[model samples]
Target: MEDENNLAVLICGAGAAGLTLAIDLARRGVPFRLIEKMDSPFPGSRGKGMQPRTQEVFEDLGIIDRVVAAGGTYPRMREYQSDGTHTEKDIAERDDPTPAEPYHIALMIPQFLTEELMRERLAELGHRVEFGYELVGFEQDEQSVTSRLIGPAGEEFVQSRYLIGADGGRSFVRGALGVNFPGKTLGVRAMVADAALTGLDREVWHQFNNGNMERMLSICPLAGTDLFQIQAVIPLEGEVDLSDEGIMGMIRERCARHDVKVQSVTWASAYSMNARLADRYRIGRVLLVGDAAHIHPPTGGQGLNTSVQDAYNLGWKLAAVLGGAPDHLLDSYESERRPVAEAMLGLAAGLLDAAKRGEMRRGRELRQLDIGYTESPLTLNRPGRWGPLLAGDRAPDAPLRGAAGSFRRLFDLFTGSHWTLVGFEAERNITSGRKGLHIHRVGPGCELQDMAGHFRNAYGLTPGEWVLVRPDGYVAAMVTPDETSILQMFFSEVGLTDADGLRH
Candidate 1:
């Protein structure tokens, strides 16, 4: 039996990335303690855009409804011109939801609200974020990670099977681990603050730019709240004053809108452009994630989104390995996510450069819908596949009919923390025997009927073809019924025996 005091995983930092991983692990019944160096939850809207991919992740985590209810869409941009006239433009082209991609547009919610929803969901799963616990130091061996933590009470030593540094860019754990964060600073400094203001239309994102691009200021209303987030570029050698008066004065000077009063400032910080990636994500039993692993410009709103994706990708692998899956299964986290981060870093840096030159544009690339892991070692694909969807592609959503005329969706079936086996025309007797597996058959008079044939076309599946959807919603293996051994081989390679199943 495992000791209750010794957690399976100890997560540092209770931000979006840390909370997400905690929620996923809790749902899987994995023992973990999520800690934050701060005494209370962050109370600002630092990273406010939730991409389509992240919405799907939230759906699987069972917090989609709460997120939708709490967040709103990105508002139109109203640029304040030099002639005292405003020009309105859409932030991005709006795309309606389709059968394949249910969430076609991004959602805008304050980062604090997003974390609150996740924390609520985590509490429902019987876990709480331990506040005021700071990880001062740690040492890890082949078997476990012993962490030195300082808290309100005092310094205490704790042990865990694994340690993850989800702390922000100034990660003590990452620094202690000696991982090299290699990248250059773009030398652009900016000041951001969340404040309650007046004399601005809350329906649009108000932008004020000086002539010849000498200065720029944007006051974006935080969705579903009475506050606005102030963002503006400062001089490379400019002084930064993070006090409330300083923030208000800076806004007044930059926007030149004396009518727009900064009534109150809640949170303020100065940040410089630093596009960097840790040379390695993992060193022995300690791992780095979120800002600790990668940091880039927030131009494309990819920093938080990418960080959340990292947690989503790593959560299941951690659960699997703790449950007895092969140790190498954990290695795929770095192999798959590093490339995505690398791409995002370049994309964000380029977008930042473009914005500086007044050539910024929003497109499908920022949505992150097309990111995949087709090149990962765990992805099994056949040559000459007859479909656009492949082994490593994201499993799309489709409508389905359950028994007794019950209606459901493909994402509803993939909502839990378990590997799902979906068969088109295969026998259930062969696929349903596995423990902790949810098997669904899609055919006439079957457990699940493709109500509109969306699944068939979306997956490009023949009658006898089936696919293995990993717990994280990636296609692990796709094969015909005659090649069912491929599933067994893949599972065996990952050591997915009874020992590797979920604890509960």
Candidate 2:
């Protein structure tokens, strides 16, 4: 028998993906244990670019203020020539914020600091990561999973209703489950380290590349910190060193400037370019996420962002299912996230190839704003006509005037861990009618008023049109208000019931 308030989920890794999932679960009152094999948090600057979509997610997680305070926009790249001259160019075109797209640019925050903020939020929700604890083994039946964990205490056992593996590319959980991770190694190896440097401008990302593209090195200044992240390509066949001398040696050999010196190395690692996708995201009561489910090159900065998204997509589904939703709801996790991983892998690979050819150009392609679930089984589009945004697309944010003469944004309504229903030009009582649904009727006397027509232009909705935004911010169903039964059917299909405990 399942206890009413005991641990229900076991997360195998305590990285960004695992931490994001844990925070969401904590907000939903889902009991879970987050375990990390490492003795402490990751202390590197890997995956430093927080894309716009991920920033939006950070906002919903209530860490936006901290993130924005701890990060800064990407700096311009200054390329050094073989003749000791340098040419400066913007890394990417800058975009001003719009009413619909609030986070218009990528923010640079070190991966470790990002994880720190997330852990802080999780702690406020009354849980902490069990560091130095390793998942030694686990087994599952139809009901629960029995896991063996080893730490300073020697051995401990836990029984959870589900097991999630977010344990990087070489996941022990995936290996034990015998899931096939299929892909090719790009035969390119790279080394990265965080260190303090001298004779380098902190205002720009410094790079050096030969005409033949045989070598490339970049030292980018990390935001909200004094350390710079050093990155360089290495021979695929040789054993590359990760010491301070090795990194400084590469910089001296590749760069035309001889005055630059590495003062100290904080953390370092050498990684080969391997692109792989798991054959399945789910098997029995076990599931995969983050680098465990898919691993790829970090050229596009999609790896970490995609991992956090996987957690976001899974968190609410897990909560709903545990709260009495259907088992099929859990299936949607794989259906929605696996394809996203596949696509992201391909995109990252393409970007890696471009960087290899010395043709890397940063643009909106890596932003991930266009990622959607148009093909998801959980999506329902029953409108007689389409709109600027589709049913499966991300719901855009727009400013609104509240009935109490106050102002708010659509994202303000979407800031919590709950599903939201928006009725355009509908009755005022529609917002107050639902309890858990968190309905917002956008019209006169309602909380959301489109005074500037921003919402109208963004959603392309007519009067009485209804849109059901999922807890994860994807549009689930869209239909006319009169077609309430269709909306009811869509909810039932997606394993959600109305506030009255009825379909409609």
Candidate 3:
């Protein structure tokens, strides 16, 4: 039996990224310890936007219903001019959900509430975060990572196969590893607060600005709650007060409306925007994820969403390695995610510039549905066999009909921690009774029937074609009936075989 105290992974930080990885590992039966330095959960309403891709991840994690119930769509932007004139416009162009993309709009829920929901789900999986445990330092070897923790009970030493730093931008783990985070601070300070206020409409996002970044103020209603999130840009030089009275004063001066009053401020903070990415993602057995690996401005609402996806991409790979896969499999996490972080950093910086110019135009890119791994080492694409979707692209969802005439969807089949091989009108039986692999056939007389032709239309598939999807919902490989051997070869390259299964 495995030692209960010895963990497969030791995760530091209890933010969305850390909690996400913990939940994934817990459901997979991977032993892990999630620790947070703070004594309690975060109380701020920062990072409140959930992109479409993140919504899809929430569905697989089994919290989509609750998340959707607790969230609301981005409201119309109500801008207040200096002459007391106001205009209303949509914050982002809304898209309806189709048969292919089930979630087409961004959902708005405060960060604290999202974390609370995830914590509840983690408890259901028989695990809970270890709060007030601070990771002071650690060292790694070829076999294991030994970490030192400072908690209420004093100091303790623990060992795990790997250590992941989901800690924020000033990450202690990254500093200990001496990683270089090269970027510039934008030299603009912004104050953000969550408070209960009177006299402000709750249906739209209220903005008071004079076409200057340093003179912008926004009060937006927080969905599923009785409060508003207030944000204001402070001057570059000088100290800005964060008290309730100071915040109210700033709001009154900017909007020229004394009727709006802040009753109370629950949480507040002042922060300077910066864009940075770690030069490397891993060193030996210690790795970085989320804000520890990259930090950027909050202009595009991509910070939290991107961090959550980072953890999602790394969770399965870490579990695979701990279950006796090659260590090189862990290397692919950085190779795949680092470039994405870099690209998103550039995008967020560009959006910040746009926001300063009062041109906050949000498009499909902000939804993050187009991110993929077409250039990863793990992806395999057969030459001259490309369709609308290719290897390393996100697998689109489609409606299906079950053998018993029950309604089904592709996401329902890809919900668990298993590899899915979907054969579309294939001749031979590709069903493998492997422990961690699931095979489904979609055709006229198969177990799953695409009677509406949604699958064929979404995947652009002809007869005798098969698509293998990875655990994280990306197309791993595409093959024809004659190229069935490619599936076995692909599995072998990823360190999985039929004899050993995916995990021992």
Question: Each candidate: what lDDT?
Answer: 0.86, 0.86, 0.88
Q: Is candidate 1 or candidate 3 better by TM-score?
A: 3
Worst 10 residues of 2 by lDDT: 427-436
Model 3 poorest 10 in a row by lDDT:
495-504
Output the lDDT of residue 121, model 2: 98
- Candidate 1 lDDT score relative to the true structure: 0.86
lDDT of 3 at 412: 92
* Segments in model 1 whose C-alpha atoms lie over 4 Å from true places: 1-5, 210-213, 427-429, 498-504
lDDT of 3 by residue, 238-338 (tens): 78887889988998778878899989999998899999999999999999999999998988899999999999999988887777677898898998999
Q: What ranking emerges by lDDT with the best candidate at the front?
A: 3, 1, 2
Mind giving the per-residue lDDT tens digits that candidate 2 earns over 171-209?
Answer: 999999999999999877888899998988899998898
User: Model 2: how large is the Cα RMSD against the reference?
Assistant: 2.1
Query: How many clashes does each candidate structure show, in the order listed?
Result: 0, 0, 0
User: Which residue pairs does candidate 3 place in steric collision?
Assistant: none
Model 3 spans > 4 angstroms off: 1-5, 499-504
Which predicted model would earn the best TM-score? 3
Better of 1 and 3 by lDDT: 3
Maximum-lDDT candidate: 3
- Assess every candidate by TM-score: 0.96, 0.96, 0.97
